[model samples]
Target: MLAFAGAGLWLLLAGPADVLGIDSGNAGMVLLMTATWTALYQVGRLPPEDVVRVGSPAEWKAWIGTAFMAAAIAYFLTRGEVLAGVTVFNDPHAQRIGRNLVLLLVAWSVLSSVMASRWKGVVEQDERDREIAAQASGWGRGALVAVVIGLAVLLGLSPASRLAWASHLMIANLLIFALMWSCFVEYAATAAYYWRERRWQ
Candidate 1:
């Protein structure tokens, strides 16, 4: 979460021109590759029992959702040239990337849904889970609202020339990033709660 947030901040500070000069698409691909390898290494390190626990249906759902959300935000922001170019809406390559990402997200959701149906009888949520979810949801919503307000204020105060560069695609990407960031925060909070609760138990 911190890494993603940092990347977003870097893009904002560097601006499109700087990002383009630095080849943001290559940077994004490198980051994605690193993340993939890290995930694989962590999974390989898990013991059999730990692997089973991690592979549980509910855990799988959470992992898939988090991964998809992060990937969507990252890919859209980078692959669509939102960081590298003036406007994603006007770039044919960016549009194609965006379409492919949407399709990938939809496919992932459908697959997760199918898996959930198969595991419906085995997977059960308890009061603790519900409490954690409620708390996380509240945090996520609050964070998202704060981000929206902050962006609004910044845009409102910016000069006309600066605002002119803030195209529709840029605004949309900002919102998407905020939403994904909130979700990441919510997941992190929930994970922390679970860790503490387990430690106490």
Candidate 2:
């Protein structure tokens, strides 16, 4: 899928373009997400005869939208409608919408996960499930560390004049963005691993 590794290259080489009202940076992510859904949804389209392998991905597919939605909320909350430099938390107009959306989304995801998954089963997670989860966990942690280190380098090495827009509030949301990104990475990897196993079947 062009939306995987290729998509990032396309985004970097293409620079930034306008699509409708959104920038290529945002649109590029949507493109990648479309690919994620396209690929991962195929797992369910032809599930193998293994409960352990099929269980996590099927459930993860259901929450892909949730992850994307949460990311969007974070994106919006990280900026002001008039001032991109200020976080929604400090921007009066954007704060209310961001707070309410975050609360509702968190609640919705929790309920959705509980309802969609067969957690009551005696088997719970098998060896395959544990393996996938562990792999995903490692990926998430690595992504988080990379994001943090990158941010530190940018702030530490760059001249203050060059980073004039880096408000305290903005820095705070950047950390939030880092966490969100790591979670998204973990989720994508989990779903991908699950989907990858299905192709052979």
How far is 130's C-alpha from truth in model 1 (Å)? 0.4
Clashing pairs in 1: none
The TM-score obtained by model 2 is 0.61
Displacement of the residue 15 alpha carbon in candidate 2, Å: 23
Task: Give the per-residue lDDT digits (tens) of candidate 1, residues 40-134.
Answer: 45655666456546545444555556665666665665554444465646676556455545654665566566555545445346776788789
| Runs off by more than 4 Å, candidate 1 | 1-56, 79-90
Q: What C-alpha lDDT does candidate 1 achieve relative to the native structure?
A: 0.61
lDDT score at residue 2, model 2, on the 0-100 scale: 48
| Candidate 2 structure quality by residue, lDDT tens digits, 95-183 | 63345335434644654564345333535556887888799889989989999999999999999889876777667766876777777
Q: How far out, in Å, is residue 80 in model 1?
A: 6.8
TM-score of 1: 0.63
Give the Å shift of residue 100 in candidate 2: 5.1
